[model samples]
Target: MFKIMIVEDDPKIREIVLENITKWGFDGLGVEDFSEVFNTFIKYEPHLILMDINLPSFDGFYWCNKIREVSKVPIIFVSSRNTNMDIIMAVNMGGDDFIQKPFSLEVLMAKMNAILRRTYSYTSVESNIIEHNGAALNLKDSTIIYNEHKLELTKNEFKIIYLLMKNNGGVVSRDKIMRSLWEDESFVDDNTLTVNINRLRKKLADIGLDNFIQTKKGQGYIIL
Candidate 1:
């Protein structure tokens, strides 16, 4: 089932939204810890989000930007502020839709359905993901997910991981990695590939995935 995360602080509004979500046969994850919306988001991995413009600690715009850094999950802004500027900001922050306050649940559901359909309808099964030992590389966002922990990666870092994960059980040579990242490696610095690999390994380590990308001395790297 698709999960919908609600980031509104008001208890009444949160309950109402969740009720409607349940009625529509979708799971609703209400955020209680506003101080760590991103943490809660990582835990839920919601397919869609209902975010309020006004939030504790940080505003929805800030959280929206953070989420966009790693995910393309659909976000719909629900706020009382209906000014043109607010709506524009919502769009700019990667919100799929903006629903004015005091909206009927029907309207909210309609918007959610429309956005969900549009976002997921044309999704092809040619998976844009590569996985090894529970570490998943999202090709579309250039991020990694390991044990529910996510890390956004740089372009070179992503290419490195992609090459390793694509050849999961086999040791990919450093030369092959450089070639995959840049068509021509002669112009690249000798240590650039090592630097990128080290960075990617550190990121993987941060998410409880230590030694995920195993080094084979002079053989290159492998995700065993």
Candidate 2:
């Protein structure tokens, strides 16, 4: 079942939203601690988020940007602030849609369903996670977990590891890796690629994954 996370601070609204979400046959996760919204998000890995603009610690826009840095999960801003600028800011911050407060639960459900359909119609939930040799890489958050130790990865590190792990046991040439990096709009030369590989290796080693990536002589790199 698709899970939706509610980040509203009002108890009444949260309760109502949760009820309607359950009624619509979707699992609902309500946030109790506003301070750890991002952490809660990582823990649950909800498919969609209902965020309020006037949050306690940080506003919805801040949290939205934070989530965007890791995952492209669909976010809908549900807030009382209906200013034009507020709506524009929501979109600028990567929110998929903006719904004004005091909205009909039915309309909310409709929007939720629409976003879910458009977002997941082409992809499975498991596609966001890739695992290799007991190490799981979260494509959503640019983080990898091995032996219960989680390490956040930089953009370069993530792309490099993702390619290697996806093509597990096969040599990926340095040229191919550089091309991938270039495709990501990160212009990295041969030396930069080497630097990124070395750093990634050290991070893997830190998580008890020593020598996880093997060098294939003059061909390229491989994860065996």
lDDT (Cα, 0-100) at 15 in candidate 1: 97
Tens-digit per-residue lDDT, 1-224, candidate 2: 99999999999999999998998899999998998787677767899999999999789999998777667999999999999999999999999999998899889989999999999898887547666776778877899877557899998899899999899678999888898887753555568888889999999999899999888889999996
Task: Supply the global lDDT for candidate 1.
Answer: 0.85
| Stretches of model 2 off by over 4 angstroms after superposition | 127-137, 140-224
Error of 2 at 61 (Å): 0.2
Question: What's the TM for model 2?
Answer: 0.64
Q: Candidate 1's residue-wise lDDT over 138-187, tens digit each?
A: 78888887655778898888888888778868999999988888888999
Instruction: Quote model 1's TM-score.
Output: 0.65
Best candidate, TM-score: 1
- Candidate 2, run of 10 with poorest lDDT: 181-190
The estimated TM-scores of all candidates read 0.65, 0.64
